[model samples]
Target: MDLRVAAAVSLLLALATTTGAVTFNATNTATGTIGGLRFDVAVGLDYANLVLSNASAFIWSSAFNQTRPADRKPVDAVTLVVAADVSGAAAFTAADVITLSAPYVGNYSGDVRTEVTGVLFHETTHVWQWDGQGHANGGLVEGVADFVRLKAGYAPAHWVKPGQGDRWDQGYDVTARFLDYCDSLKPGFVALLNAKMEDGYTDDFFAGILGKGVQQLWQDYKANYDA
Candidate 1:
């Protein structure tokens, strides 16, 4: 290899190492059906791995600011399985494993690759996020994942708009929108909350960070964006 090229490669590898080099393994285990076949056609294992790398970079640098390994999950690898029979959900992550519903891929009417990329971002967040040692609010947890997807510019059109949900912790897009609002009030608010949840979670953390209770913040968020 040319010396310049080798030096560039070394630098990239060094950066990745500093941020924690987590292996991403992606495979389609549902190739018995057309849904799985569609995954192979629209998004092969190679692209899935790329999304994993991209999502990790985005979560650390842009969304969550978890640039250090100690600030995020310590897993050494994350696996993504594109499989069928995963009904009633587009994708979900358990521990360091992400399962994408091949059936959803086949049935989706939009850009399959783009949708999968967005789903990958959401699921990847689950793998890296601090979960309050399994005691965090489930809705807030899901919302944070969706917030990453939202920040990635992949929020679907059918999602509820700002201030549309009945509660701040309504989960998914609702809570994601609320979090976006919170981030606006205090830059890096989501990142702060995420770092706080490294070991435990409390609604009171809102007061510590923003000088207001979570409920009061929610009310202000609603009033600010309600149409």
Candidate 2:
């Protein structure tokens, strides 16, 4: 996808937030699949059902597409909604619903049946991810989501390049791109960072990865932007 188009999609989703409690059908069975990968979607609900269910799972699949087998199921059953215009995107505040753009679905050359599955992985991580009890940096929150997407090999073609964009924690694709740099220099770096976030988040967490603070990571990331 073109960067502009991807950015538009991201922005649309960002505005797609709702402020109501989520309701589920006790008998409501949902199945989710992406690029042909499937999984049990309801296993990790209620932990933070709003964040852990569908949204997080979709993002998770996107980030870790390469980590799963082609026939593997990522979630048991969730309604996969492919919207030509993201109309149903905002209808969900609870992460329990899997939503994807129509163009995104059509862009996959892989067996991935739907983009919603991939996007779920990223959102699912948010549900399960510890945010230092809301003290975590938003950029890192988004970056980690993309990090999962990067690791999963679903990163869009436009995401391959690095940059001295806004700030390191600029969130979403920008932060994800920087996280990719850290991962390149330090194997398992993203994993370690995720572990750290699980317990609690701190700026010093970067020290654990690069022997420097996150600010330093940002600087280093920018320095190598063109390399």
- Among all windows of 10 consecutive residues in model 1, the one with the lowest summed lDDT is 1-10
Clashing pairs in 1: none
Stretches of candidate 1 above 4 Å error?
1-14, 17-19
Tell me the lDDT of candidate 1. Answer: 0.85
Against the reference, the lDDT scores of all candidates come to 0.85, 0.51
For candidate 2, the TM-score is 0.54
lDDT of 1 by residue, 155-186 (tens): 89899999888888889999999999989989
Task: Report residue 143 deviation for candidate 2 (angstroms).
Answer: 1.0
Model 2, span 111-135: residue lDDT tens: 3322333465465455444566567
